[model samples]
Target: MKKSFTLAEVLITLGIIGVVAAMTLPSLIGNYKKIETVTMLKKAYSEISQALKMAEVDNEFMEEWNFTAFENPDERVHHFFDYYLKPYIGTLKVCEPLEVGCMSDKIQHLDGINERPHAAGKMSFITKSGYSVLFWIHGDGTGGHFIIDTNGPHRQPNTYGKDIFRFILTFKNSSNVYADTAGYSKGLKAFGAVDGVTREELTGGNVSHAGLKPNYGCKSGLMGLYCAALIIYDNWEMRNDYPR
Candidate 1:
């Protein structure tokens, strides 16, 4: 008779394999998710940066662009998006102010407690590449915030610093002097402004930076406004200690 493994032996071997798989599967899945996040984030960043550069060639420097021509906030946001970004970025669809389709209805905090909806009167759109772009123009029109959702609005983990990142536009001006302190030369920059800062410094355990409240730095329990900067500081790779 051919020598075959006993049924009990075969069952034991299978049980051991199952235990090992169950232990390792979550880690493998998490790593894959991280890789996917990094890839999408890099693409979105590159696309937006290149689009801005191209827009400058046609509309002149962002600092010189006149958004004050429009009185209404919504109108200014729309004009800025339509005239400066939409053409270069190739948006697939534009969502009106406070619309639900283009962006997540509620964005959660990293701690997973607090939740906030998209800003009122801000124009948002979906890019052809599946990224969600939202614009919040300041009243003075000097600059504003750009919120990029790497996986679009419908995706899960709609929390900041994970799938959602924030960028700030500072139109160079004597009154508006973020470039000098933030170490970036103006125009657009990651929210924390990580030009000359290291990852540790950028994501330090502080709750405030340069007098900005709630400090958007990549620290846990805070609004992850500077998480993009942290990733950029790490050369676009999510560090091992990256908060989710």
Candidate 2:
């Protein structure tokens, strides 16, 4: 006789299934979110790179522009972004420098718990692609730096290396920059550094920042600035082996 299961048996079996799901569901969900973030990051990088190439075509020879010659740094920022970035990129709204709604009020580290106000003189705006960008020109013609919130400020966990990432506008040939060849400043590079974390091997494991920690992007007081390069080093995919 194909008898049906008793009530208690069915309840127990269902309870076991629930327990197993409880054990694994959160992790699976978290991993999916991480993958989503990675996708957004790669998309942001590609868009910005394409814009840069266009900017190069529009403004012939960045090597000749002398933004460094400007006295007031703000003027340099205005000129560079207006001419180079504003024209080529799609900015839906230009936040009045640090005006509210431009970006997240606080920038945090990747420790995943610490929350603090980012005390820095910066300016940002919203892009049509749904990213918040903090742009700064060193007032030198070599190009500047960009801090991007890949998912925009609307999303949570707005932590560095999570929703936020940093990149440089380098004129120098950044190819083959892996290992110690990160002579970023030796040539006409951009931002605070030329090469990113790919220089880990050659510099005795040093990123753009001194004594940088591995997989530590935007953490430890932004010491993890090279973390994106670290991700790219891992083939543009975040693996379980990557730092949390």
Best by TM-score: 1
Candidate-wise lDDT, in order: 0.76, 0.62
TM-score, cand. 1: 0.88
**Candidate 2: misplaced stretches above 4 Å?**
111-121, 173-182, 185-222
Tens digits of per-residue lDDT for model 1 on 60-115?
88778777677788888888787778889878888998887888888876766655
By summed lDDT, the worst window of 10 consecutive residues in model 1 runs over 173-182
Each model's Cα RMSD: 2.7, 5.0
Candidate 2 has what TM-score? Answer: 0.78
| Model 2 Cα shift for residue 174 (angstroms) | 8.9
**For model 1, what is the error of residue 232's alpha carbon versus the real structure, in angstroms, after optimal superposition?**
1.0
TM-score of each model, in listed order: 0.88, 0.78
lDDT of 1: 0.76
Candidate 2 lDDT, 58-80, residue by residue in tens: 88665555676777766777777
